[model samples]
Target: MRRFRPYLRGEGLILTGGMTALIAATIMKLLEPWPLKFVVDSVLRVEQPTDVATVIGLCAGALIAITALRAVFQFLATTVFSMVGGRVLTRVRSDLFAHVQRLSADFHEKSRAGDITLRLVGDVGMLKDTAVTATLPLLGNVLVLTGMIGIMLWLDWRLALVALVPLPLLWLATRRVTTRIGQASRAQRKREGAIAATAGEALAGMRAIQALGLEGAVSRMFRGANDRSLTDGIRAARLSAALERMVDAMVGIATAAILWFGAHAVISGRLTPGELLVFLTYLKNTFRPVREYAKYSGRLAKAAAAGDRVFDLLDQVPTIRDRPGATEAPAFRGQITFHDVHFAYDGGGAVLAGLDLTIPAGQRVAVTGPSGIGKSTLLTLLLRLRDPSGGRVVIDGTDIASVTLASLRRQISFVAQEPLLFSAPIAENIALGAGRDVTRAEIEDAARLADAHDFIAALPMGYDTVVAERGANFSAGQRQRLAIARAALRHAPLLMMDEPTAGLDSASEEAVARAIDALSADRTTLLVTHNLALAARMDRIIVLHDGRLAEDGSHAALLAKGGRYAALWRLQQGGRVRDAATG
Candidate 1:
């Protein structure tokens, strides 16, 4: 309820209107039986009537008017509830999506994409039906039931007692069944999420499954989850059906008891036949709410489970959020320093153990290390993807954590290995960055700088050509060049390239190397690569080994030192005798 309070903040008028309509409808329902009773006891039962046709006509007209009024109010109430429900849920869905997006990278690392989608799409959808059919209807019916029962007792207390005998038993039976259904419904909803996740995984990885010939394995996994979901759904349905039958039986028993007891009262002249008919009608009408409760119990249980899931998701606070008084960072000079930075994931072994390093503005540096030595961790820290456990990462002499994430990232242009390009026009892909508004000439100039304009122009639509998935339509070199073009257009002070020329053929590598050289000119660049040749070209080379800095100097200076950097370079170059002389 607290979770829903914000969404229902301004719904007072709609609820009031709906409540008024419900009361009017209930009054009309109570009056419906009176007209029939009057016809039976007065017009039809009179031995000497002055005008029989006129009396019958009046009674019939009154009955029709009451029925028509009830229908109108009922329609209004239903429409109001439906409108309120739809509007509230639309806001809820939008909020849920925005919250999910704001969550940290660490949360996404442990959570399944498909499960989140199910919560956003499936769980929220259940609340819609609950609001309309289960929630509002149950509330409205309770009020109607209370009013009708009072009228029943006033008509004849003894007959009302007979009618009420089976109610307590029915309530007890429904309570027990609904609890079990709720448990089953929760399990069923969880299994349905698993099924969705399995299908989504299979669809997204279908290419890999085909390549590895693992289709049968994936299919079997999906079947197991699908079967469990189906079993739980059927069990819930069966329990609901049983509860419905029990309510029907209780209704019948109450009806039978009232008929048997009330007939004697009327015959003995203790009650009029018209009054007896009214009491029976009230008894039936009072049970309408009970029957509704039994019928919607399963649906209500399902909605409760879904509501828990939705609120559970909404309750999760993002791990990385702006603190109070956090200020937006101004434009950076691109100077970077890691001051005794220590990082560990989930309290595991440290990836960076008390590492310290500094880079002056406008200096291009290359980072080289073996696999699992935290080469990529350095870039992530600079990007603020994850904060260090101990110490600060300062950019332009200000702690990055103290500044807004958007401001910090806007100044850095990153070109990741296997660069992600969307399915849009080539010009649009090139222009996508911190500030997306770019002129045509600016796009062409950036493309030319990255050595990509010639190939782009040779295409049928040139810059207007739409890329396929991640730019699979072009060669690897073309994709890398376009990524460089994108970074060039951003024109940020800092640029980070992770293995930009990796996994390419000789021709592709040469083309990408030229683009990297052009893009790095006069920029504050941090390059992570295993290519000794590329590292040799940087203004300075930093080598990381076993989560600590092992070497930092210009290529020639490191070679002269004959230290860790020299050994790595020699090993990659197969250590010629001429190279050994310099070492």
Candidate 2:
């Protein structure tokens, strides 16, 4: 409730209007039975009543007018409440999405993308729907119930007390059934999230699944989650039905009691037949809220579960955020220093342990290491995608942590190994690296520098050509070149590439290597790769082993030392020789 206050604050006026309409509708409903009571007493029971036909007509007209007014007010309340709820939820969804994007990469790494997506789309949507169908109507019914109860007591206190005898029993049954229903609803939501996660994972890796013929395995996984969700859903439905039926039985018992006792009162001349009819009518109306509650209990419980999921995600403070008093960083000179850096992932051994290294301004260096030896971790630290657990990473002698993240990251351009591309125009994808505005000519120049212009121009839409999902429409070399073009457009002082040519063919690797040379000119560059050919071209090569630097020297010098770098070079050469012989 407190978390939702900010979203509701702006809709106060609209919300008040809705409440006012609901109250007015409740008043109209309370007046509805009175006209029938007048017809029963003033027209039907009166001996030689004056203007009998006129009285009957007036009572009929009043009944119609009361119902029509109630309808109008009810419609206004429903519409206004729906509009306010929609607006509130829209803001919530927008904030949730932005918050998810702002969270650190570590949170994303540990969390399932599909579950996050479910909270964003499915859970929020459920809240919005339940607000309209269950929550708002329930509030309106509660108002009606309160008004009817007051009227019932005013008409005849004895009959009112008799009619409410089953109230405690109804309350007990509701409390028990609603608890079970809520539990079932929460379980159902969890199972549904699992189903979404499984389906999303399968679809995202459909190519791999098809290649490996794991369709049956994936189907079984999805079916397991789906079956669990169905079981929970059916349990909640059954409990909700039981509660509704219980309320119906209670309402029947109360009605029977009201009829028996009120008839005795009418026989004893303690109450008029008309007043007794009004009491019975109010008794029936008063229990309507309880009946509605029983009917919508499952939906309301599901909504509560959804709200819990949303608020749980929103409660997670971002681990990475701008520090207090952090200032924007100046343009970097590109001299980088890692001072005794120590880093580790959660529940894992150190990936980099007290490792010290430095690269002078405008130097080109390659870092090579065995798999899982923290080669890529170096770049992630420099980019502040994850900060070091101990020591500092300094750029131009300033601690990176002292500066705003946006300002610090803007000075570095990184090309990931896989070359991530979103669904956008080819030019837009290139321009994203700029992080600011860039002209068409600049984009084209960057493309040409990366050796991507010829291929991009050959496309039907040229620069305007839209990239398919993850740039799957392009070949490995084309994607790599485009990624290089994006980095080139940034024109940052420090450039980093992670295994950029790892999966490319010989022709594509050569083309991409040339593009890398052009892009890295006069910049501080750090290349992480296993390709010794690319490393040999760098000014220096550093080999990491067991999370510490084992060797660092020029390619020829490292080869002469016959150390870790030399051993890795020989291993790659042997693999190449074997491949060539097979060919």
lDDT of 1 at 133: 77
**How high is the CA lDDT of each candidate model?**
0.87, 0.92
Worst 10 residues of 2 by lDDT: 41-50
| Residue 538, model 1: Cα distance from true site in angstroms | 3.3
Task: Please write out the lDDT profile of model 2 over residues 445-498, one tens digit for every residue.
Answer: 999999999999999999999999989889999999999999999989999999
**Candidate 1 C-alpha lDDT tens digits along 437-552:** 78999999999999999999999999999999768799988999999999999889999999998888767887888888899888889999988778888999999987789999
Model 1 lDDT, residue 548, Cα = 86
Quote the RMSD, in angstroms, for model 1: 4.1
Q: Which stretches of candidate 2 lie over 4 Å from their true place?
A: none
